[model samples]
Every structure is written in structure tokens, then in C-alpha cells.
Target chain A: MSGLEGLYQQIILDHSKARHGDGPLEHAAAEHHEYNPTCGDELTMRIRLDDAGERIEELAWQGDGCSISMASASALVDLMAGRTLEEAGERIDAFRAMLRSQGAGEPDEELLEDAIAFHGVSKYVMRVKCAMLSWVALEACLTEARATRG
Target chain B: MEGMSSDTLGARRVADLRLDFPVFRDAGEHAPAYLDSAATSQRPARVLDAEREYLEHHLAPVHRGASAAVGRSTTLFEDARATVARFVGAGERELVWAENATDALNIVALGMADASAGLGGAEASRFALHPGDELVVVEAEHHANLIPWQRLAARTGAVLRPVRVDARGLWGPAELAAVLSPRTRVVAFAEVSNVTGFLAPVAELVALVRERSPEALVVLDACQSVPHRPSDLAASGVDFAAFSGHKMLGPNGIGGLYGRAELLDALPPARTGGSTITRVTLEHAEFLPAPHRFEAGTQPVSQVVALAEAARYLDELGMAEVARHESALAARMAEAVAELPGVRLIGPPPGEERAGLVSVVVDDVHAHDVGQYLDEAGVVVRVGHHCAQPLHRALGVTATTRASAHVYTTEDEVDRFIDALGGVRRFFGVAGAGEQTGVVA
Candidate 1:
């Protein structure tokens, strides 16, 4: 597949259209709002941590953005819904590293799952920001959620 | 270049002028069909070389020293100012140097803020606004024009009255008439809508402002119109106007603020320091008049020189021809793209007299995705709200993709853009690619 096809995989398009874990997390520990002024892509994410504050018990978000950003946000919730904060951080780092790699980094497909489709997006210097917008929000909200517990 | 229209004026001139720009020359196969000139124009060889020559030879501070080098540099700089002044139809003293068009508008707004606060004494009262007064601006204005007026209104106790735009993102003289009143202190607007390419009826608006609110000051954000057409700011009867150099084949970081001599002299200087003072004391200092007072600190001398060179180049080509070339190109582009399935043209309908720009919203495809698709097809365009969020909200689109043209634009480049835009919906799988939904003009 070409880079454009790889970037817009069937899974990404489906996730973008019918996003999972989207729209308002109730009794949430933390929430964050992020906007990309360049293209006006916006995302508001809410997190509900478990009683132990070790795992993200629930992750919900709402946003209006391009297919890349929407899909990335959807795939993020899918990857980290029940994972520990440390594991989520690792995944975020790996995703960021792959995006920064300029289409060169071999991301762990087992960890990234649907997000590995964005490896083609990494090739585009501009679209990397689109793919990473929600992940950045998640990182910030996660940090805030951890602080709220502490 | 099949389907290229032979009817457009200056089609041959565009072909000839294409060679002056270096970007088309260097990038052969990978050359982007540039259609984003309204955002920022690409400089020609003459403009670039002028700046290089100035930097290489005459690099000295203007208007400061007693040395011959300083005198020579000051002459070059002032000469540039004069050339630019003539280009925009203002007197030498009427024009002030600014960082860019945004800075120029800010100079006026901030200066007015100072005036409202009793800064320039009694002479500045002409600009002072009170709680009951209203600052008028149109919804379709670029943020460069709108935000400054908004801040001005906030700083003073004046109310902001926006003249509403239609669903097409256009406002007419009737809209302005509806908003005008005796309490209107300032009327600020763009001579051309950067996003929608609506050519504002300047003379009619000025006349209406004069008739209804005689005391109201008129400020024009001339960033779009000044570059593409022949403009006489003095004749237009606006109190102040701002436009950038880079949009007119000139160097960046240089722009002009044209204010009527009476208003400019009375208006308080927003930025102050060296080169602006007539007499200095520790507590109180007397300021120089108009352009000198506004131009604080060491100026962009090389940029000024290049900008003047750019103005001269444009003058040689004739602004009328440039305007005709770009308008025809935009009209052609509008007609071509408006026919595409699910594609919506944002400005005036095809064949309307617009100011060389075309903005569009594709159904079910975000503007970013459209821009990406165009980029992949080697067709560059501007994407986003284009710094006019309120207008975008009014138009019911979060963002739009704009394709604009300059003097150097060719029919082939516009064709490439139209063809690329035609394929966007199909590539994105937006549904009903071939099936027309009556979008054709």
C-alpha cells in the first residue's frame, strides 16, 4: 500500500467514524482540553482512574478534527482503557518516537495495534502533529489524574 | 494545458512573468502548483537581489548619524518609503514603516487607545472613544483587521458592532448602512476579504460613513487589495490603512501604514524611543510628526529597499494588468472547482468580480484532509480558518481551503489546482464522487 493508504487504513476510517470511549467520562478524576490552532483540531479528554490509582479505569473523549486525529484518539482509548499509567506512558512514548522517526521507526505492532497504521502518517512531517494531538492530551490528563490522587 | 481559456486578459503576460519567479525554475518535477499567494507571495529575482545588494553595500543605521554612510543609508531608506508611498497613492509624510500589516494596524489601534486615554493632548481627541461610542467592523474581516478593533473597543468603553455577513461569507453596503449611527467612533474593515475574496465597495462605504457618522474614523486593512490592484488610499478617504510588503512580491518584515496627514500628525505614537523624539527631557519629551514619530528605533533598511524595488517592478508591469490576470485566474478556478461533486465555493459565485482568491469547503472531508490530498498531488493551498474564526463559524465550516493567485500565476498552475481539487472527494472516499449534487454554478 502507498503511504496515503497506509495512513488511512480501514481500521482508522472505521474508528474515526464510530469512535469508542468518546463523550464525557462521569465522576472523572481529570480532564484536559487541547486544540491545534494550525488546523483548528480540538479534543477534550476525561479520565476516571481506578481506586488504586494505578490503572486508567475509564477514558472518554470528545473532539472535532481530521480523520487522523479522530482515529488516533479512538485508538488511544482502545489501547489504554484498562492499562496501568506506566504502561500507557510507555505506549505514548513509543507512539511519539515512531512519529518522530519520520517513517523510519519500527513500532511494536503488538502494543500500538490500530495506531501502528499511523506509521505512514509519521512520514508526513505536518500530519504527525494531527496524529499526536490527542495522545498529548492523554499524557497531560494522565499526569493530572495521577496528581489528583497523590 | 488542455481546456485553458484563451479569453482571459494577460494570459501571455502570465507566461512571460512566470520566468521572473525562481521557485518555478528550480523545482522542475517536484514543483508545486502554488495557489496560496494571498497568504504570502513568493518574491521574484529582482526583489531578492535588491535586498542582497543593499545588505552587501549600504548597511548603516538610517536617520541617526552625522556620517556620510548614515546619510547615504538614510537617503536609500527614505527613497524606498517615498516609492512605496507613491505606489499606494499616499504622500511621503503620510506613510509609516511597520513590521508588517498586523503591526501597522496595531499601531493605529494602540495609538487610538493612547488617544482615548488623553495621551496626545487636545489634538488626539478626534480618535478618543467613550462608553457610548461604537466601533464598526464587518464579520468577514481578517483577524488582522478585526482583533485590533476588538481590542480598541475593549480598551476604550466603546461597543463593537459587527456588520453581519451572509451565508456566502459576504457583506454588502446595505449591511454597513444598517450598522452605521451617530455614535460610531471608528469604522474598520478590509478592502478585500482575504478568505472570501469579496471586493468591498470602498467609495460607497466611505460616503455612507461620512453621511451617517461624520466624526467616525475609517481604518482599512488593505493587506489583500493593495497587493493585487492599483490603490489610492488618499482618494479612498480612509483615515488610516495598513498593508504588508511580502504579499506584493516584496521582502517580509516590512509593511506600510498610510494615514491622512492631519490624522497621522494628531494620532499618538504607540511605540516610542530613539529616532522619534524632537526634544528629550527625563520626565517629558516632545515627539516628531507623523511617519517619523511612528517609525521608532532602527528600521528594516534592506527590506525597505527591496520593497521599493518590488513596488517599482509592479509599477513597470502595471497594477491593472496584474489585477486582471489574477481576477481571471480566480474566476476560472471558481468555475472549474464549483462544478466538482461535494465541493462548495465559499466566495461570490463564479464570474463575479472578486479579488483574485477562491476558498472552498468540501463535504464530508475536513479542510486539513483536503489540503493533505492537494499536497500529495503537488498542488499547494492554504488550509484552516485563515485567521478568521468568526467568519468561518458564520460560514458554518470550521475551516476552508483557499487557492489564491498573484501576478506570476499561470493558467497551467490554476488548472493543476482545479484538477487536484476535483479528485479530493474521490481520494478521501467521501461518497458520491462522480454524482453531482447541483454544486455547479
Candidate 2:
């Protein structure tokens, strides 16, 4: 019930207007394109990592889609911006579980605050694809980042 | 659905033609009148019974076996073909059965692929496409007609050029003449446009093709026209035309591809595995001529038979009468919707030039929301870009809600549609009107 059902949610609308994931990356590894063909939503998620392998770095995403996909990408980048590879990986898995609602170890506390608003989204199953699209892209970017850094 | 002007067709109110469709009968009493016939017409008792009878009593593999049942089935199949031919004003020899109009059009485009690949001999000469050649189709063509030609042009390195329709979705003589150049080797069009209901002038367009791009064979997507109009395909001068049985109150899996005999003879087969060939060799194969060449495998015999029944049903009703019935309904629907607020009606708007369908955009509301709202009130209409994504893009919207009519559609259904649509703005809270008479102007 707590999903971003209303397209006019003030903070979400403001964040969408403010543009969260437009950062300039100094050094980036790989850029991945994710598209929700059914609804014509598309986004390219890019990740930047330093040589240390486990430390913080920059992330940027750009494209067009519905409010949910764009907002999810915005909130996802906010979380993954400075988190370490392992912590990001854990968060991505937890987010995936939360979206799918598997009865596993409870997702990390912070992701639940804004990110778990999407947890109620699975109840409206069709929109779950839109809600989880960015998280999947983030997961993909992390996997690619890990492969290159290792 | 249009509002009923007294429940009479020509004279008196009778055993409603609307009640013949079982869905309406089963849906309690007074269901939402299904006005979207161009999307797909509801099947009547005869078409349904014919389908069930064929499946129950006459099911058999077509054109291969020497068994008595097989022979009877093949006879039934070919008889169905003849029915479709007669319905479309074609000879039995010229019409080939396809899964649907999409499959029929794809068969033409894909057969061209086989031709370009140099498979069919002299027969494919007319279908050949080369670099810098042009494939001309109108922009308002349904995706079924537009995409295959696009893929064909891409495959052959030919330019897929479109003759444009303006903001009101009208195709003009001069615009079409400008596009039908010498380099244009194939021109595909819809007799009745799927979205806007803008009826393209086939004869005039064919005359232009003959005068300018003489070598360009004309392919007509008759999916919209054949169902609604009593057509004489042979007289139209189109080389290849496709139509679906389902849209005309027949079984879903059967459609007809009408080609002028020589065109069918020359067009290469898109799918070739069985039933098409007379003799199969390790290196070479000799295929059967015309209709059979395109029919690669076991035909949908039951659907074909039921389609014949469906054709007979329409024929019995008199296609001209059905056309008149639907035309009056479409005009009324347009008039009613035009009066409602925020409804910018698409296309030529209930004139002699329009087809049996109409699309509209409501100001400041999404088509899906409109569809959902209408569905709640027991009205059904297709929402979204309607597979003409580029057309909608040209119209500067992602989607529009479309409602179409057929013989079975009653005027009261159209009234229900208009009345229900008037309630959408309030449902979405986009406009503050409690009664939903939110005027766009």
C-alpha cells in the first residue's frame, strides 16, 4: 500500500524534477542499457569505480521512462553512489528479495526506508517489473564492476 | 457505440441482430454494447456453430493424404477458400489462406525475401527489390502493413518511404502522387485505415502507381475493408490483398490473401516445409502453383470452414446493408463523441471518406485511465497507440482510445460509450466537475 502509487507525491515529484543521477564520472568502468519494452521505458546506468576495488565511487544514469522507473533509478543511485562493492551487492540482493518478497534475512535497515516503499509494489504485480527495473540495472552494473575490478 | 435513433433498422424494431452474438446474451441482460468491431467483430451463432461442427465432424489433415476423410476435408477447405474469394470478389484460384491478415501481409513481404534470395524463378520477377528502390506506403497504415514493408526495404536495401497524412488523418491525391515515384517498386496501403478510419482511394492510388511507378505492384491490407465493405478485389487492380476472417465474425486462425492469379503464381513462398511442393529433391524442389505455394503445412480446416460460414453470414445480411448499418453507427458515434468535452476525435470524422473506426484523445488524461474507467462502466474500447506507434508519435501523443462499430453494434452501445467517457475526468480527479462534463475548449 506504501508504493509510489500517486504520480503527484511531492517529494518524489521534486526529486524527479531536481534530477538525482546526472553526476559527471571522472573514471567509469561500464555502462549498461536497461529497457522495459512493454511500456517503452529505457535507461542507461553507468558506474565508476576507483582502483582500490572495495571503496566508494560515482554513479550516473540517464534515459526516459514512467515515474516509477525514473524514481527508482533516482533512489537507487542515491544508495549505490558511495557504498562499497560488497555492501552494494548485499543491498542489491536484499532489494531484489524485498521486491520479490522472499522470506529471507530482513533487508538492510536503510534500504527499507525509501526503497522498501516499493516492497508494497509486488502486490500490484504488473508494476513490479517497472519498480524493480532500476534495481536490476544496478545489480547488473555491480556485477560488471566486480568482474572488471577483480 | 452510437445512440439509437429509435430501435429500427430500415423499418421496424425486430429480433435484434445484436442478440445473435452469445457473449451479449450471456453477459446478464443489457451488457455494454461492444462498439469496437474493427478491433474484432463478435461472432454470430452461425459462424460459431460452423466452427464447432467442423471440429466435431470434419477434422482432417488437408492436401496430403489419399484417405476419404482427407479428401472430404480438402474439399471443405477449398470450398471455404471459394467462399472467401466470392466474399472478396476473387476467383477461387487467387485466394490463399493465412493465419490472419498480419500473417497474410508477412507472407507477401517474406515471399519477397525468398524471391530476393533468388528461390522462385520467373514468378518472383515482379516482387524483386534492389538498392535505392522505394517501397511506398501511407503513414496511416496499420503496423501490420507498415512493418513488413519496412523489414522488406531494409532487407533489400530499398528505401521505405511513406506518403504522409496530415493532422486530421486525411490522405490527399497530390500527396500520394508525389510519393509514387519511378523508383518505387512496391506500394502497400490499407483500404480502410485501422486507427483514423480514413479510407484511402485504392483505384485512384492504383492509377497513380500504374501511371508513374508502373512496375511497383500494389499490396492492399484489406483487414479493415473486407469485413465492412462488399469488395470486388479483382476490379480494384491491387496485386495482393490480405484480410482476416476473425475480424469479419469468423474463426480467429483463418484469413485470406488475395492475389491476382499471375501475382500469386510469381510470388515466392515465405514458409516452405510441406504441402507446398509437388516434388522435393535434395538440391532442388518444384512447388505447387498459387494458393498452395504459400500454404506451407496443414491448414486450419475448421476455422476455414467456419470462416466460410462467417462469410455466408455477412453475405446473407448483405454486405452493403452491413456497411450502411455500421456507417450510420460510426457517424452517430463520432457526432456523440465530438459533442463531449475534451474529446478531440481523430480522422475524417463520419464523412464518406472514413472507415468504420475512430480514435480520440481526451485532454489531460491518459488513454489507459480512460479505458479502465470505461471498463468499470461496462464499456470496452482499445487504449494505447493501437500498434500504430509512429502514427501516435506523429499525432504527438503516446496513445489514444479507439472504438469501432460493425453490423452487430447497436446505437445504444455508442451512447453508453459517450456517456461513460463523459465520466472519466471526474474518476481521475483531473477535472473538478462532479458530473464529468469537463469542457476541453
Q: Can you list the residue pairs that collide in candidate 1?
A: none
Q: Could you give candidate 1's per-residue lDDT for residues B61-162 as a string of tens digits? A: 999869999999999999998999999999999999998899999999999999999999999988898887999999988888888888988888899999
Query: What value does the lDDT take at residue B4 in candidate 1?
Result: 42
CAPRI grade, predicted model 2: incorrect
lDDT of residue B62 for candidate 2: 82
What's the distance in Å from true for residue A34, model 2? 3.4
Residue B316 lDDT in candidate 1? 83
C-alpha lDDT values of all predictions: 0.87, 0.77
Query: Which pairs of residues collide in model 2?
Result: B1-B413, B1-B414, B2-B411, B2-B414, B123-B266, B197-B355
TM-score of each: 0.95, 0.83
For model 2 chain B, where is the 10-residue window of minimal lDDT? B6-15
The digit string of per-residue lDDT tens for model 2 on A32-79 reads: 778765555567878877767665488888866544566677878777
At residue B297, give the lDDT of candidate 1: 88
TM-score of chain A of 1: 0.95
Residue B89 accuracy (lDDT) in model 1: 100
lDDT of 1 at B29: 44
